[model samples]
Target: MKPPPGGLTAYEAAGARYERQPYNRSGRSGLKLPAVSLGLWHNFGDDRPVATSRAILRKAFDLGVTHFDLANNYGVPYGSAEANFGTIFQQDFLRYRDELIVSTKAGYDMWPGPYGEWGSRKYVLASLEQSLKRMRLDYVDIFYSHRPDPDTPLEETMGALDHAVRSGKALYAGVSNYSPEQTAQAARIMRELGTPLLIHQPSYSMVNRHIEGGLLDTLEQEGMGCIVYSPLQQGLLTDRYLKGVPDDSRAATSRFLSEEQVNRELAGGLNKIAEQRGQSLAQMALSWALRDPRVTSVLIGASSTAQLEANVAMVDGPPFTDDELAAIDELTGPASSANR
Candidate 1:
């Protein structure tokens, strides 16, 4: 089959890229991230079509999303997302790389050995080297330790992040799935090493408000930015499964979001409120997540360009009212039983 015409030329980013969404500064750093960032946790794997992934990425960039979040173990086959992105990136977005904020992470089970994962300097550095090679990049804009290593000393983990920046493998350092206390310790260590903690990636959503307990306050106190993942609660907060879980939905196919977790009663109630506000549940959910000033960006996953566009439209919706906010909490309070 013949390929689309002006294949590459068709991708000039929208002229109003900067005007599309408000960009917030990442903590005290000079870098500013878009209101919504694209997360490649799903849909970019080798299991999906490369053309689909490429199209979604192009649409996201065209809509002014500058940050692309990934991890070493993102794909089902592990590293396939980065490898696939590397191919499309080299072919299409290589020239526009300077305008992008590409981020990747480590500190998870990537390879099968003790040295293959965790916070030790050797593992952290080696993981990044492998990530760089897979992504075909000189250096990632923001590199993160995907999670805290309980056994690995905090100093060693923070030092590894420090080394990543000092060695020019990553322009910034971030930590994910860390608690308030752990974040405070990491910040202290990074400060001592002359590298401020750049950002914290945590799971936050209307249904999952675990970060609100104290982590948000800690990040603000530490002057670190926050880019939350799973803001959609793995598609639960959306209208996708309000009626019932479809066979093709992630809930049915993925282990992360199970069929039993789809609370239809909660969805029906939230959907009415969304309709009253003249918005979709997904749009309202995105807007709600971004309401906090501490959130630098809400990292979202999209399986198609349409979903990406719909998510970006979230910025245009009206802010929630006190009543609306209360209603959301009321509905989510029961459904928030899921582990963060």
Candidate 2:
């Protein structure tokens, strides 16, 4: 069979140093994560086509993006993304497992009934086991609670996280969508158990700035790292919609980021700033999130190989100038409105 377009054959001719992109320490841990990590969040779900999903993952890892982030409920049917990844991992990359950083999460709705979700011990530990079964892996590099379960006690969640790390099922533990207060609380609990809470994942972008409102400061104070999600604001921070949304674009078809909202209002100064840096709006948005040293990586989703290639290229560009920063700040105000 012919090699997949924009797939493994893109650089089959040369030896790879695998040092094109820089890596950062994941919190205070000895392991380092690449600046950009691929997320099996949206497009890896069952409803989407699978070949492109395979290509995106393969190309991403080939480009030195060793980290792959996943969660238990990542498919249209929930759990299908993990299953899909299992097939890919066993078929194409099992031998190189040591070279990869695999992560999965629980704490959201994975099953049904009372034991199905949240941060309870019964739920969190069971969910991680289910995830490992689906991914066909013995252990994940990191495991996280998908969200802060207000109903479940923080100690229960922290206990599950520490247990996962201690039992050799997960090497590290993290939390997502957590507030500064919750993070602080989790840290105290995890530190007492000797886990050291590796990182926090949050939805952050030039257009979505919720993490900036003290979350960054809190992370800095506590010495935790952050891996930001949706750095592109779905597809709003890309050239795909600058001239108006393309018919086949994510904005036009995606349920996560809507089309009407793009027509309503977007950070207007993005085009000018992106043009100044010779990058697409998406590239600029990724850079904006990574500009903060506290961020360990930007978790991005791409539906196709071309889009992934374009998004990854942003790392090679030059730094933003003072005037460029001022222009961007002036353009995208602090509304935190979704482009959708």
Candidate 3:
């Protein structure tokens, strides 16, 4: 559905929105994303209240969070997050279209048929169309191949992304969950196609530091920005799991984070470090992730405005000292060199 005749006037964004947040250029590209972007992977689903979801989106934009990330199968029932975001967009963000960086990905399972998933030209292109319809947008700012497909040729997958950009369905192309070698190959193909891979979205945090070994270097070589997801390790790096898994926490209800992986000993140590730095565990985790200049942005999922605000406030925290870095590495162990 189209936006209201004059757009929604009840909710006006803050005049100092840009002042509240900093922007970072996505690699060598002209695009600049907010230092901390909001991802609709968790709380924007149909299982959650629409009012809550709407509030988060409005708060994010008002705080100058220009980038909002999503995937085709993000919600509980699948596709609900995009649908909810689409509704919120029509009511709130329609007028600020050019000011936002809306993005979505494909390659994950969204349907049952052979063409339903993976990086095939058919699946990738078709999924983009579906995502656009669900999000009620003509085009997304960036479209990504969610993951690499062993069966489909790399050329076919990259071609789909190239087509997405060249056809105006997406402004730029990206990939996620790809290894260093796969990223290099994908970058090569997109560059040859004249579309150039713009970024890579990978899971990274204090505990999950696999990207440190090679992905960061590969992205730097390819001139592609790196936006990391799960910077909190699905709430593992936060104080939430310090005492024990809360009944309402992701560890209790979600498969992505299990109760068995709480690692209270590690979190307790990290929490102590955060306390010494005068910041919360979540804030310190985010600050730590952005400590690497190679990282362009960090994606955070929030269940409330308070959570979102606190995470965004990490930008104001003091920089990590050499001792702090060493302490963190000591607690979390050295970052693995294993590619993935």
Candidate 4:
């Protein structure tokens, strides 16, 4: 609102730093997004300092990271993520809204009671209305059903998605945490409703490889793009754990990525592979996920601007060599939640 402090457009120096990165196509869609997108899943709640969050958001856009991801349940307290984004949107990014692709989802637990979470049309619609109010926007570029709700009817969920696009509330629809089979079904239904399913947001990294098991194939065939979250495997794939958890890492602050999850054995294996590649494990993890052409973008989270700068630079890092791939295979091996 106040000219975005230093202006939303990057200064000459910032533009120079961003000159080398290229945008990638999101499936067969006309959309061209940066290879790296930011996820506001954490540190965007009421508890975290807002100034730091706003700075990160401003820096992200200035450097060409246009797509920002969020969900109803992302905050330390529910609905805070959207509210936080809303604040930044009004404060700094309002004028540059056309240069942004803002997406928020509503399939996870956001409030108490039976109607609060899941894929029900009633719940989805209500959640979206609240999100719109919080985000201070008439529409979101992409809206996702956070996950499949087995108890709810698929038609009802798909119907809500269709209505969102048709009613001019959401430009595109996506499904997160859905199996390959489920994604196909939704795509089929959306086609009939005249709103093509646009993307699939899945948890994928070198450590989390569930999408490799036919999910990638389905998306390719359906003309839906894929954006993988936790591209650093909850920070395990990063060098942060190589020397054991630091007090500042996610392992210390959140239960989502526990220290026990990054046990010594796992960290050792990752460190060896990272060293061989001459890259930080975090950079290597991002490069690994981006290696797949089906992955239109990797959804990354950073607590600070410096961390984001290091994370996105993975785009400029080396591509995997045969020996590096072989070593990674021997270490991380096949994708299994139990193994690493």
Q: Candidate 3, residues 26-111: lDDT per residue as tens digits?
A: 99999999999999999888899888888888889888899999999999789999998998888888889999999999989999
List the lowest-lDDT window of 10 residues for candidate 1: 1-10
Cα lDDT computed for each candidate against the true fold: 0.89, 0.84, 0.91, 0.84
RMSD of 3: 2.6
Among all candidates shown, the one with the greatest TM-score? 3
Candidate 2 per-residue lDDT over residues 1-340, each given as its tens digit: 3344324443231146286778998666787999999999888877877677777787898778889999999977799999988877776678788989999999889888999998999999999999999999999999998899988899999999999999999999999989889999999999999998989999988878878788888888777889998888776777667678778877777677676767324545687778878987788889888988989999998888888888888889789888887777777665354441
Clashing pairs in 3: none
* Ranked by TM-score, top first: 3, 1, 4, 2
Q: In candidate 1, residue 9 scores what lDDT?
A: 45
Q: After superposition, how far is residue 315 of candidate 4 from its true place, in Å?
A: 1.1
Off by over 4 Å in 3: 1-9, 337-340
Which tens-of-lDDT digit does each residue in 1-340 have in candidate 1? 2243324344556777777878999888899999999999999998988888889998988889989999999986999999988987887778799999999998889999789888888899999999999999999999998899989999999999999999998999999999999999999999999999999999988778888888989999999999998888899989899879899999999988899888888878988998988888888888888888999999999998999999899898988899998888887873363546
Off by over 4 Å in 1: 1-10, 334-339
> CA shift at 218, candidate 2, in angstroms?
1.2
Estimate the TM-score for candidate 4.
0.93
Instruction: Give the TM-scores of the predictions, in the order they appear.
Output: 0.95, 0.92, 0.96, 0.93
Per-residue lDDT of model 4, residues 116-230, tens digit only: 9999999999998999998999999999999999999888999999999999999999999999999999999999988889999998866667788889999999999999888
Query: By the lDDT metric, which is better: model 1 or model 2?
Result: 1
